[model samples]
Target: MTIDHFFQAAKIEGFQSPYDTIHLKIFYPARMPSQVEINREILPVDLEKAPFPVVIFFNGFNCDAQQYQWLAVKLAEHGLVVILFNWIAEVMPGIISLTPGIDVEKRKPTIYRTVPTASALPALLAKVEQLQSEGILAGMLDLQRIILGGHSAGGRVAIENADPDFFPQIAASFGYGLHTMATLSLGYEADTILPLPDSLPLLLMGGTCDGIIANSCDRYGISPGNATTPVIRTFQEAITGGRNDSYLLLLEGANHFSINQPDSTLKTPLLDFPATQPQESFRLLMGEIINLFIDTHVRHQPEASQSLEQLLNTPNPLIKSFERK
Candidate 1:
């Protein structure tokens, strides 16, 4: 678990559904890379210290992988092999332009229909197995430590699909099934009949002032913000159900778009809020805390355990409150 590692970037466009084309943007620790697409092109880095933990991150509705590059680089710096890909096909082009007649409610069912709740697990698992077998990523993947996560609609997908009992179709669909170590949902929750498997550790994170979706209040019954659907109920359900390993974080004065990157052209409605806190401040906070959380749960790093405890006890103004149960 070496924190001092430089990440090498690569873009491969093979992972896809039968009808859609999926592009996987990967970041891995490398001594050097033969070429750099976005940053710089360097020779291949020594991967003697390879087989890093995997994080399959799904982007929010209409958001693409490029939007989350900032967070991915930070995770890659800490010896994580991060994969960010476009899970849905239709949400694009429109998301970039904010065209007229764009409604989240109308778009959600499209997402539900296009994006399989559990198909991604087997698709990614097969892709990984193929890459490793061909020696392209021989020792660069740690499948056993995989974490499935996403934001907004993508987050809901992670939650709904992670239920092994509810969506057993994915297991039977593919020959090999994935055993995800944990699940992380950012600023969103699903309205699922089946709860997340008790064995799976879950992390629900959101902002108190998120005008898009209020996490501070029980907004399901009472409409207070732009979000018609609330996710706080999921947190309450997990906490009271005796899932001592689950956790929730509510960031103070942060909005729904705080963790997302602003498009230079399109005016995202979520970003229309007044800025009380610097955007990078939220990104740094999220990256650092998420890194520590993953380190504690995935790598079993004792230092992260101690640091998390210390940070949790020593309160800060940014974090309004947290429930670790």
Candidate 2:
């Protein structure tokens, strides 16, 4: 599937997810020079301050990291270190863009059937260490407060690989338009869902009208509208509800590409509903909701749960449904 997306991207400058794909882009809160905005400048690490929470985001299938810079900026603006990356593999001899070079094509399972997505963490940490060594982000990161997140396929990689028992530094895991349902090739069975890490805090976001998940069902020879509510079921089934709290947030009138704009023309929304809200509005609300989740899980703020409860219990036009467990 990864190679299939690449071939589509190679045909056009803007097909699938092509161009400006960075293997790594780390955003941090820092003093901007004279008049430049936050993301416009990237130096003078705020070493005197306390350790900043870290967030590493993986990209969706064939999705580039550049498009999510807005999100990185949003999170970093709130004093978090956000790292965006891709799982670029050397599929053919000479094709490479946006992939983090992790050789995920083999699709081999590690101990207990987990994919090799965890392999990307070491490289990510190494880069963080390099930045600190150069005094770029020195003393500004707390690896112990790490949160792993992603969208769609990338989100699955994060949730599946985030093992706090194995990698205690990870504080939590989150996903947007993500699920753990295996395709036919991956041996998915009825009523079976991928297991999440032990006692891991989770946040799963979904859309009531996520046409991409529904429309893409044909790839596995399944019906088009089968997976319209897969994220909700994923949350109900995968969450190991003890020691850590988990949440499910379904947005009203949202689609698969709601977190960010449709980056490529290849995105087929034939099965999606007309977006009731603008993408900008969707992202602003998403940023605030993510802030609450991170504050509750990673920052250990008991007060954050109050805001979350308000959103979950009170009726809202933005959220179709909200539940906690």
Candidate 3:
């Protein structure tokens, strides 16, 4: 669904999940930034059909979950229940506006927060179960088809969580039949290479202009004049080392800020290249690519698989490179 359509759909009456104690803030993508505190809105879905897949998305470092609503909303429109959960700390409404004299550190995470990144998934899953038990998502969730996704620092969480070696203890704790079907990382990567098991899948999407994470000159190498990332190196290792379920997509002209909410205007040390395409177009492309990827790997939709194949084979202005092993 288009962004406008997503807003229209939100206006229609739908189930409003009760105060979610675990999910501090949730939003149904709107024309403006509007959040539903302690609750989540399940966009209009056909009740006669099977329940929708679940997507729990965490925001990048120093960014609010609402900044990624452009993505959460679109995913919901395309038949998934998207949950945008915030990290332990985020910018308040007041701080974002009183910015001219604000210290650089004040704009971002000022406190040293230490919630084990691995705990994010399990904590969220417990909250989801609580919501379901309370009839918020009763009979409307296909708990089997769950996907864990995140951006930047959040992406690191998803990547590390998917690896059996990183969080074996956490995985063992979730013996309640809940598992991450796949992991999608955007604008983030591990310091070392991490390859998923043959049964699980990985999709890594980042921008060529992402000066923050994509800053390594070569795989596992870094140079001062370069703006590449370790994600590329790790992704290459996954495919070459025989992880046949891995996939990677590089957005040509997109940047770290491009994936955030359109309303954001905070400045950063990262460079902002002149856009060759409209900003919203990039967000749409991101949503479309993510939707198709989830459908093919998580939902196992044949049509989505075909579409992904075409997008990879045929060159597009937006997609710099698409690869699957």
Off by over 4 Å in 3: 1-45, 90-116, 163-199, 214-221, 238-244, 262-265, 269-275
* Candidate achieving higher TM-score, 1 or 2: 2
- Least well predicted 10-residue stretch by lDDT in candidate 3: 171-180
Clash list (residue pairs), candidate 1: 31-45, 31-46, 32-43, 32-44, 32-45, 33-42, 33-43, 36-41, 244-325
Error of 3 at 169 (Å): 15
Ranking the candidates on lDDT from highest down gives 2, 1, 3
Cα error, candidate 1, residue 227 (Å): 7.0
TM-score of each: 0.71, 0.80, 0.67
Candidate 2 residue-wise lDDT, 44-80, digit = tens: 4443334888888877765777767778888877778
TM-score, predicted candidate 2 vs. hidden true structure: 0.80
lDDT of 1 by residue, 1-325 (tens): 2222222222223323432445566766655433453254433434664677777676665666678888778888877767776544333444331111112331243353333344445556566655556544565676566766666655655544544454332210100001111121222333331234444556667666565453323322343453212445556652243645466677776666677687666445444455478878878887887777777876778999788778766778777777776
* lDDT pick, better of 1 and 3: 1
Residue 124 local lDDT, model 3: 63
